[model samples]
Target: MSDINIELLINTYLVPFGLKILMAIAVWIIGGMLINMIAKLSRKAMSIQKIEPTLAQYGESTVRVALRIALVMVILEVCGIQTTSFAALIAAGGVAIGMAWSGLLSNFAAGIFLVILRPFKVGDAICAAGQTGAVAEIGLFSTTLTTGDNVCVHVGNGKLFSDNIINYTTNPYRRVDLKCQIANGVNPQEAIARLKIHVAKIANLSKAAEPCIEILEFNASGIVIAVRPFCNNNDYWQVFFDTNKAIADTCAEAGWPVPAPHQIEFHKD
Candidate 1:
């Protein structure tokens, strides 16, 4: 090929193409960094305004996704692609896209409702869709939870919103229910009295509510005494374990016999 023809080819196609590619990469990197900064600033602003953390996080995530989408369109425009035409194409296929992404749309809707309803918030310990944990984040499509075992779980908002939600952290305090089984010979009234004293001494027990100790029922094993203590949600587990220990210690100190099942034998001829 002639040098003139080669120079024309390089200038006309290669140079422009290379420049477009570089521009696209620059836009992508810079756009991403800017989006992150904006999101961070927005979150900080929300914090300053005392906005709810759950809503703040969800807003940040949604804004970031939207900005990223716009950035992609800008990059496409830089690459000699017409974003207007692309948008038009998407609009033309909106029905098909909506049908294909029905579940995602439903999840998004459910997430909005979750935020609006404020059933549970970030850091709340809730059981939803059979998963119990502290809510880490409420996203557009799902909610993140950190379980007692420290497992991170992401549950679909649709499923979580549709199912029963038990928000343990909503109330000021929760009741810790424990059962004590005493041998038939042990006096139920004495056992109940002892339990009340020990359970009252448990650390973090709620001062707002007194411990309730009463005979629950008579079981095959023995007389079942219900030991109920109230404590803040944050101290629930501690109070629970401590209450159990209190019951055991009370039984041992009283020298009560171990509860065992009793059965009557009969012979029919």
Candidate 2:
């Protein structure tokens, strides 16, 4: 082949290829910067609108990912690359990933629903999925809670959404349930009267609703008395513990038998 012909052939192949590669790189960088900027702006706007931080973060991440994917397709086209096979590959990959991570995706979707619905916010005490705690963080896949004892727990958003959520702090007050077992021989009316007196003296107890002392059940060991009083939800634990202790001490001082299971043995062989 002639040198000029060889030179022409090289130029024909290398020049366009080099130019297209440069264009692809430039597009990728610019597209990436634009996507990032847009995502940040979206997050700021959400924040200004008083959206939860967790929701804002999830929104920004999702927007950035979508933008990046679209930018990549544009970059490929700019580089003179046919995207038919590439698009098919991406679709197939996505399908496979979706199938493999269906559980996680479901949780993510549930988290988004939670963000929109606003069932419970951070710092709210809630009971769901048999776990009771204060909400610490809400993420794209899981919700974090800190228990009364300060143990941290992560619950999948799917599970949280599927189960019944009891928001304790949603209402102003909660009824504290207290159970006291007294000897069946003791006068039920007298025990109830004493309980009412003690409950009346409780400083922080809510008097909006009258306190109740009902003879709930007669068990093998004792007569089960149910004491229920209303109190602020924030004082639930305090009221519960205080009432139990006070009931025990008061019954003891009054010479009442605190019912407990007893065993008798007969020996004859």
Candidate 3:
């Protein structure tokens, strides 16, 4: 190539592209650092306020991601890319993606609603989507729950929003309904009376409401004795497990045996 042509090319294209590339790199580096700082600060602030951890973390991460995307667009413009055309293409892609994944987008929208409405928070035991469990995490698309048996469940936010959500830990107190099956060996009335007394004496039980014991139904096996006890949410699991164990032990030690299965006999002519 000629000397003059080489010089013209460097001035017209090479130098301009190089400068823009350098500028774009600078923006990417600086923008990433700023986004991180903002997220950290927001999280720290929420922590100081004692806000729910799930909400705080989610908010921080979302904001950081949004800012990073904007920064990327700006960097592309600086690199001599046509930002208007790029933006139009992005919009078109987003529309296609949204259409292709409509259900996922619905779940994402429902997740935002869940976070805003604050129906249930993290660590609360809730019944939703035909499953009952303590909420482990609330994500952008699904809510995670840990069941009684330690199973991790991920429920779509769209379903959770549409269905009824029963939050057990919302109030300070929760009612524990325990059923004791009547056996042929044990006296139903006497057993119910004893259970009522035991429930009242148990630790952490709310004294505000008196425990009630009654006969619910009589099945083929035996009668069902219902024991309703109220306790603090913090002590819910403890009270439940302890009461079940205590009642069984008490009945066994006292020789109050459950009856055998009832069977109907038919006579043939």
Candidate 4:
């Protein structure tokens, strides 16, 4: 090749390629900044509309990802690189990933349903999947709960939705089911009357529903008393513990002893 031809090749080929590279980089940087700004705006808008924090965060992330993907395609086209093959490859990989992690994808989908449906909200006490707790957070894949005992648990949304959910805090009032045992010798009617008096004195107990006290069963141990009352959900534990203590104290004060398991002794001559 002639020296002049060599110089022409460097200017025409190498310089243009370098410029294209620079342009691609500049486009990526500018596009990335704009995408970030849009993501922030999306988050702010969702927040203003009172969307769940986890859902809003997931939305922002999804938007940022889509924007970056489009930016990559634009940059490739600007650099004279064909992206149809790239898009096809990405689609193929996505399908493979989806097939391989179908369970996880289902959980993600269920999480989205949970957010949109609002089956339960943050701070609500719920019983689902055999676990009872207050909802701490709802994530894209899992829902977090803080149990009454203060232990944290992460439950997949798929499992949560698959089972029945009991939202204890959905209503301001909750019906408490309590069972108390008294000495078999005690009169069932008398015991029930004593219980009603004690139940009335408990704080936060609802007066809308009259307390129910019934003699449920007679066992070898003692007569079983079933008590049903209404109270605020927030006062569930308090009312439960207090009512139990009061029943026990009242029985003791009345000279009634709770029955203990017994076995007959026999001797043969």
Against the hidden reference, what TM-scores do the models get?
Answer: 0.92, 0.71, 0.77, 0.73
Compared with the true structure, all predictions reach lDDT values of: 0.94, 0.86, 0.85, 0.85
Cα error, residue 19 of model 4, in Å, equals: 12
Rank by TM-score, descending? Answer: 1, 3, 4, 2
In the predicted model 4, the residue pairs found to clash are: none
Give the per-residue lDDT of model 2 (tens digit) for 1-269.
99999989879998888989999899988888899889989999999999877677778868987898899889888987778988788787997888889999899899989989989988799999889999988877889999999999999999999999999998878898888888858888888888888877776787677778889898877788899988888888888887887787769777987577755789999
Candidate 2 lDDT (Cα, whole model)?
A: 0.86
- Better model by TM-score: candidate 1 vs candidate 4: 1
Candidate 4 residue-wise lDDT at 211 = 76
Residue 1: error of model 2 in Å?
A: 24
| Model 3 agreement with the true structure over 97-187: per-residue lDDT tens digits | 7788999989989999999998999899999999899999888889999998999999999999999999988887888888878686568
| Residue-level lDDT tens digits of model 1 in 6-104 | 999999999999999999999999999999999999999999999999999999999998999999989999999998899899999999999999999
> What TM-score would you give candidate 1 relative to the actual structure?
0.92
Q: After superposition, how far is residue 88 of candidate 2 from its true place, in Å?
A: 2.7
Query: Among these predicted structures, which one has the highest TM-score?
Result: 1
State residue 111's C-alpha deviation in candidate 4, in Å.
2.3
Clashes of each: 0, 0, 2, 0
Cα deviation at 211, candidate 4, in Å, is: 2.4
